[model samples]
Target: MARNDVDLLDLSLDELLTTTRTVRKRLDLTRPVPRALITECLEIAVQAPNGSNQQRWNWHVVDEPDLRAEVAEVYRSGMSGHQADPNRATRDIDYSTEEQQRIASSVAYLRDHLHKVPALLIPTVGGRMDEADIFLQASVWGSILPAVWNFMLALRARGLGSAWTTIHLHKEAEMAELLGIDAAKHTQVGLFPIAYTVGTEFGAGARQDLADLIRWNGAG
Candidate 1:
């Protein structure tokens, strides 16, 4: 009775969790995302677990046109390396030829139009990783990744969508200088373009077999 006493929000938890697609072409560039909604999602995000409960998460939300443009420019610049590799978009992907082309087109579209997305969310941690060993770096990243996932789940629940992007992090220092982030201290983990998706009817994408992915008793 104690568990039943609490009323949950009117949402399908299974559907919400699975259908929170990584939106690219379907991201509604024209729609304006309310700042308040983003704030609410982030409030949910901070509830995630972290190293020693350090709670070192900080979000840099850029909605200003000029700043978004600059961030988008830096983000798009990351594609240059991929340009040199002709098969970068289609290499070893699981999707079919048509699906692969569709994905490639969507990726290109998102890259070109990232500046027009309603909001740019950058998740950061309050520490640097330059000298950290692999295990230490894993701990550092482990602290923030859960919160970022929480943020994305919360956004999905609210009919918003975002892509988990790290290309821009390749230019993290330059971007930090542009955004006045103290690059020496904070590490920007990802660059996510957020918006109310054009339609909320999302579904799971193609993935490898669960049995193939599962490792029973450290079989791997």
Candidate 2:
């Protein structure tokens, strides 16, 4: 189908929600993601609101082979520590046997050739916050996360998929230098591999009921 003829509104809510999974193994690594599409998604993403209307977010897209390898190296160095951390490892949702194998294969592929993925998106925030100030830190992240998620949603609608991974930020300084990013001034919030999914169909994910997650006005 031609890009212009694609209708964003055609996607059902469930299709949007389910298909937007962290596409790792399913990423069509062999196919290339066009620059125009990435930019189109970003245009939609920036429409997401930020704190006090400060549109300080910036996105860096990496497509060169050399640069991708550098970023992948930095990510690998960090992944070891991140995977070792009990807190981090425990956070991943458990998968069924087939699903687990599929995810594991994808993760292994990423670990080995993340640099080969057609496009790498590094989302950044303009200002830095003191880590000691809890509220300030939260606000900084609050400003960028919404737009990032929106960017992912936009990609899904366009027949592309991405996974939010920060394993490379373990060596944020190295990654910043490799990408010519100023870590002190701008925070690289997350790294994602953007590409078309191998299959067009995606099902909804499992989650708890909203009532179970929400608290009553008086604390039941």
Candidate 3:
């Protein structure tokens, strides 16, 4: 597909939702992604409901070569020790050992090559929640996360892909300084690498049975 083309994938709601994979190795590094396409996705993204209708959010995009390289360096530094393994947090889940390895490999690949991705997006919301109460934290995150997911879905629809990554947050201060973001006034959500995928086809990922994972009513 041409960089300027806006031909979207013909996906139903469910297909769009289910197949929006966290792309890594598949990111098309050699091609350029049009800025207008990203703007179009953000247009859909901001439509997500936010707290009190106050859209105190900012989307920082780094497409310039030097800036993207610097940010990618910070991201690599943050993952220095973290990416040695797949997330231990998921160990308790039912994923097989092979699944874990596969995930870790893809993550490592992205970590090493993130600088080459076409664009990097960092979404921020107003105010810090470092010491805030659960209600406050929930309310704050509730506002921005929906929009981020919406953005991801919009990217999928437009033949682009990105992964929600927070490893860079370990060096959040460095990132903020580099990007000229005000750390005291806003919280950086996550880093998203935007690029057209090598292929548009994706399948649903593995998951535990819904019946086993879900709790109906008050049942545990």
Candidate whose lDDT is highest: 3
Cα-based TM-score, every candidate: 0.87, 0.86, 0.92
lDDT of 1 by residue, 1-220 (tens): 1122322234688877778788998889898988877888898899999999998878999999999999999887776655556667545676667977787788889999999999999989988999999998999999999999999988887778899988777678778988888888899998998998887787677888897788888886
Residue 204 deviation, candidate 1, in Å? 1.7
Global lDDT scores for all candidate models:
0.85, 0.84, 0.92
Which candidate would rank higher by TM-score, 1 or 2?
A: 1
lDDT of 2 by residue, 129-218 (tens): 746388888878888999999999988888888899887877888989988988899989879998888877777776789887898787
Candidate 1: regions farther than 4 A off: 1-10, 85-96
Candidate 1 clash pair list: none
Clashes of each: 0, 0, 0
Candidate 3: worst-modelled 10 consecutive residues by lDDT: 81-90
Candidate 3 Cα lDDT to native = 0.92
Q: On a 0 to 100 scale, what is the lDDT of residue 65 in model 3?
A: 93
Tens digits of lDDT, candidate 3, 1-220: 5254688899999999999999999999999988898898899999999999899899999999999999999999888745465663544665467877788889889988988999999999999999999999999999999999999999999889999999888889999999999999999999999999999999999888888878888876
